[model samples]
Target chain A: MSRRPSPSSSTAVPAARYLIGIDGGGTGTRARLVDSAGRRLGQGEAGPSALGQGVDQAWRNIRQAIDAAFLAAGLTPAAEADCALGLGLAGAEVATRRERFLASAPAYCKLALATDAATTLAGAHAGRPGTIVAVGTGTIGLARHADGRETSANGWGFPVGDEGSGAWLGLLAMQIAQQAFDGRSAAGALARAVWRTAGGSRAELLAWCEHAGQQRYAELAPLVFETEADDTQAAALLAAAAQAIEATVVAIDPRAELPLALCGSLGRRLEPYLDAATRARCVKPAGDAIDGALQLVREQIRQPLAPGIP
Target chain B: MSRRPSPSSSTAVPAARYLIGIDGGGTGTRARLVDSAGRRLGQGEAGPSALGQGVDQAWRNIRQAIDAAFLAAGLTPAAEADCALGLGLAGAEVATRRERFLASAPAYCKLALATDAATTLAGAHAGRPGTIVAVGTGTIGLARHADGRETSANGWGFPVGDEGSGAWLGLLAMQIAQQAFDGRSAAGALARAVWRTAGGSRAELLAWCEHAGQQRYAELAPLVFETEADDTQAAALLAAAAQAIEATVVAIDPRAELPLALCGSLGRRLEPYLDAATRARCVKPAGDAIDGALQLVREQIRQPLAPGIP
Candidate 1:
């Protein structure tokens, strides 16, 4: 139903000779190339390709990473018709962005698209059933059931959601700073630090708020972690964030059977705050999202096309 | 120290025969006119003039309202030289905005500026000693002591501050709607209503958040009020907002000795939720902020220039 150009039907193309798995995010993009036998040929990295940034930028980064992988493998770069692709990208959950991203894909023989969280989960478990809590500037929990069903929690974005993420912690810090500014609450060290960062004046804070977004707020999270030991407000904020993260994990995989991995910069930091029972079930991830992307492409090549599809 | 132009010194102008008191806010600007004896001459209204919007827009709205007031009074529209001005406008508390606004003042014979909260308090008490809780899209409490000293609580802007304000209610509603979307919370009537208004899709919500501001969030407040009776989340949100309003009032005047008036649309709505002790101390305001503005100008004329002035 999409108006954009579609790749030629599988029957009209030669079988792909190479598989490329891409893990694309807001910070950067990574590519892993594999031969037909599933052996890793090479890996490469490039700048951010977050789908939310825009389809063009995402594709540009994706292409650069793929080319780097080919160069490292010491082989001529594969044409789009010679490769199959598996992409786990940030902002792929939004339907419109996902559609446009798919439509923009090069004429690869086969392709699969999913959210970064999905790839993270697959990577953590090495293509097995497991769960993952990714807590950076945003927070999301993903679980893959034994039956291949998947579920997600949180990851609703900043301000309204992402309760246990960096942005959430920063928001709490800002509120405490405001309360301190108005004398409604005590000006603890954390509050004072944030206030000084805002130029120690209400006017400066106003100006900051006018343009403040998730990245700007996330910059304050480090102060929360630094001051949590001595500042009551900061400690409380961390505790609440940990609780939210725990809730997300429970919501995604209530049964404690599957291996759970805490991923991302803020994810590991929250480990100490999680309850002992939940912490007992946690396991270190077997691989990264880029590994999961490779696994995805391998599966796509084996299946080739869904049943009943010509 | 401001680089902007300063108004001509008060001693250089003739004694003013008319006073114009303007209450400017984000929604609209209102103006009241009075003669030497303090008799009401006329009233007029114009578009929003909140200084946060920009100095040029604020002045444009203020001038329009003043002109409308003169027309209503059936008097030749007085030049700025013929009238002294008193303005209690939103965003006036920020020093930069205050200075810029003062510099942009039309050549009024004399002018005085105060925050809208201060003017609301002054108007509520008719320049006497009293306290007031003003809660519209934002919330602030102000108290004037018998000694002519004044203090304020809250009034921090939206999202980070302004707890118990219209925008606060709207923000809570949005969060609840998001929780419902993620299946983390039940979708009650309020959540359903909000989601429907937002096009009931995650992509649409993401699109909305990209451009959402205080005004956009504040628009959700009406749903909270309408659903509060039957929806648990809505009721809880209102109760919390009321508690915040109560806290602001208590923080401003702990003893509850001063006459207290609850002003603004959201403020009056919170009255039913206030505790018996706090509600008992509440009194109806004698006049609106426009009247308070007139009183401000009247007082300025009586005192003329300050004692140490040129």
Candidate 2:
């Protein structure tokens, strides 16, 4: 049996108004210690700590980041004990992994774990009922209602379905290169640019791509974007990306009444791509994922929703 | 004067003896030396020599490959200078480039440069004269008549077009990835595999893709093929590729009789993606692009075209 550490054993967080919020993403983990009055006392950041990676790694990352924050504030790690904690983690939707994470994370006075998206959505809506569509390394459209109802669409990984994502744009550029190679058509400068951008030769590009262990293909999307005006192929690819995102939003809810918030790297970049028609349909939210995490903690403190939000 | 070597400088070849055919592709240049006996004597390969790349590079690659073939066959490069040469160049259709290549290359007793697809079609029809649709890195449908007339369709470069080519497959795969990322829909294992195959992590993949010296991304298409069955998104992407090719063929001549010879790697690998209806209209060519090149050279030897074939 795994022994659960007793919160009472620690001499941290005697303050009744202590609170904490964490944002665990694919790239890294971040945590902030705040007070009941919404004053931020400490903040921390650490390495890549997505839960899908595994609980041990996630915990370690979060622990390191949180520890840094505490150290910076001239406090002990145990000071987190006085806080009500909220964690918005990537891949928290996977029930089994979530359970494992919840079971293993070091003790806090009170804790809640949810998807990174949820926190992002909460932040964007400032804990109000609204929808948030995020497009980062991938894409996803998520919504939460004032009545606590929720709906989600898309978020398929890269390559096969990232919509207007960088991966999607890069893939389109690849197709252009393939066409150029087949002698069916001329890709003009775009093909040359892509090959040159990847590496000097096809062999080197393939080798580097295999060895890099990064979604390197997605990186090529920027070149396509940069050359769009001069290269029709690039322009068309971008248009297709925009259209794909529009499709996702339409799928989520055809009506424009729902408050739709956009977040994530790609999401921020897609503003120009969004047609006037799509822009008219979505209401911009007020906050970001971080804000949402804080709101969730505050709400939980006010009224805990344990068995789940019905 | 860029040293325009006179075509008349070389010794003439016997009317029914040998022919030289070249397939100038993106990666490198390939030339085949065939005799009237239908035997392949010398096959040479060299670095990128696409006419679009530049006349100097093209000439250098072609000459290297041709020289290698001559060396392998115990013949001097100068000895075959009199043989008629048929060049199927990736960028031969571009008027300016074609003329430049013709002026630059070592003078054969007779020579002609045509679009690479022309060679594929001629070879597929075995020089008899018929419609041949070649689907590979790109897609093109060509109709040839015994009277020497030709009509072509659908080889536009991607992402706007290229129909049923590798470019098309790559483009579709990218769109799917984007769609998946955007939360428009769910993509299966294929997207994941594609992401994994393209360097693993987001940053690594991005770096490898965007680096100016990296290799081309088309080399990674095999990953999609490997995971096609297990990944629905990939299967769909491949299906789109086959459909694009079939569409290109249909656009060529709706009622044309097909003995549609297929070309290109994807043409062979994703054959199953072609529907039965499309397959019935397909043809397997007896010869390859090299044969077509041979036929072109032989024609130049017997009766040079009005000097406009290039």
| TM-score per candidate, chains pooled | 0.85, 0.55
Best by lDDT: 1
Model 1 misplaced regions, further than 4 Å: A1-21, A27-48, A60-85, A102-111, A254-257, A305-310, B1-11, B15-18, B70-77, B199-201, B204-210, B254-257, B306-310
How is the predicted docking of candidate 2 categorized under the CAPRI scheme? incorrect
lDDT of 2 by residue, A105-130 (tens): 67566777788888998888777777
TM-score of chain A of 2: 0.85
Compared with the true structure, what per-residue lDDT tens digits does model 1 show for residues B36-141?
Answer: 6778898889999999899999999998898899889998778788888889999988888889988877888889888888889889989999999998888888
Candidate with best DockQ: 1
TM-score for candidate 1, residues paired by index:
0.85
lDDT of 1 at A153: 79
Q: Model 2, B1-310: lDDT tens per residue?
A: 4433245433333343556788887677788877666688888889977675789998888878888877777777755445667888876766667777877767566676787889888888888767766666666778776567776666644333456566556545544544453345675675565556554443444343333121243554666687776887776667777776676566555565546766776676766778897777667778888788888776655543333333
Residues A12-32, candidate 1, lDDT per residue (tens digit)?
Answer: 345878888899987789998
